[model samples]
Target: MEEKIIAHMTAEALYDFTLYHTYSKFAGFLTNVLGLAVGFMGIILVVTGKSPAVSLVFYLLASAAFLCFTPVQLKLRAKKQVQLNPEFKGETEYTFDEEGITSLHDGKELSYSWGQMKKVVATPKTIGFYYEADRALIIPKMDFKDRFVPIMKLAVEHTVPGCVKVR
Candidate 1:
């Protein structure tokens, strides 16, 4: 609704986005596949009556790996990114209009027209204006306070319908 929405980007916010982005991709699929395969093997072993204890251990291990491995790995990656990247530790000012969005961060300015954006993804905790397949302008919901709805509305109006995902 406002001409410009400025949000301070913190290291934690960057870390959160990194973790969410990584988990939403191939890593998520791989995690599911690996977990299912191991668990299925355990089930097969149990049905065949081949060492019930060992099968149980396999099942537990599979579940643990499924629930913990990717999250831990992603967390570490996010932390490292936030710590190592200067861009992730500063304030970013975002301007939204009918034409597009412009972001000014760390004395660098980047603008993206609605047509140029690949997608606009809104999750529970963040809204990502993705211009490239692997790059995005991430806005944490926490920073938006009460202005989240207007921002989403503006995005929906300017961005392509099929490419806008708000959930």
Candidate 2:
């Protein structure tokens, strides 16, 4: 397997993350919880059989909050990767080596040592490391050749055996 690295994120990656992580997981949970809360409010509205205004207000507030969170979360996340690796202007060839991982930024190369990582994760989607939050270098999982996961996972595991194979 060819040694791989994180390049600039593709549109496909952003779309996949928004679709799977944002909608399926986050929205799903939010909707379920809000559904229950709304149902109870609806029941209260009917039982009281008065003040349709109360029900309307509750629904509007909940809906507004939900709408606000989605874009805000996406923006904050987008801000982070851009800031953490200021040199990552997209599509830069990130080189991973024994000393550190270096990538070109503003025509200069910067390296991040393995010591900075809390741990490395080999997922079906990317080679990610959790430095603080969900910061990871997502690569096309499909780009991997045979046993790519095993080899990548092996290298990190050899260096930091504590890395779990969540892939």
Highest lDDT: which candidate? 1
For this target, which candidate reaches the highest TM-score against the unseen true structure? 1
Model 2 Cα lDDT, one tens digit per residue, 86-166: 543455555555554565646877566666666565534555544544554454455444545554654474455675445
lDDT to native, each model: 0.77, 0.55
Task: Determine which window of 10 residues in candidate 2 has minimal summed lDDT.
Answer: 11-20
The TM-scores of all predictions, comma-separated, are: 0.84, 0.54
Model 2 whole-model lDDT (C-alpha atoms): 0.55
Q: How high is the lDDT of residue 13 in model 2?
A: 47
Alpha carbon lDDT at 124, candidate 1 = 61
User: Backbone collision count in every prediction?
Assistant: 0, 1
What is the overall TM-score of model 1 with all chains considered together? Answer: 0.84
lDDT of 1 by residue, 1-167 (tens): 45677776554666667666776898677877888887777877788888576667869687778967876776677677667777666678888887899888889998899898898876666788899999998887787777777877888888877888877
lDDT of 1: 0.77
For residue 7, what is the lDDT in candidate 1? 78
- Residue 102 lDDT, candidate 1, scale 0-100: 89
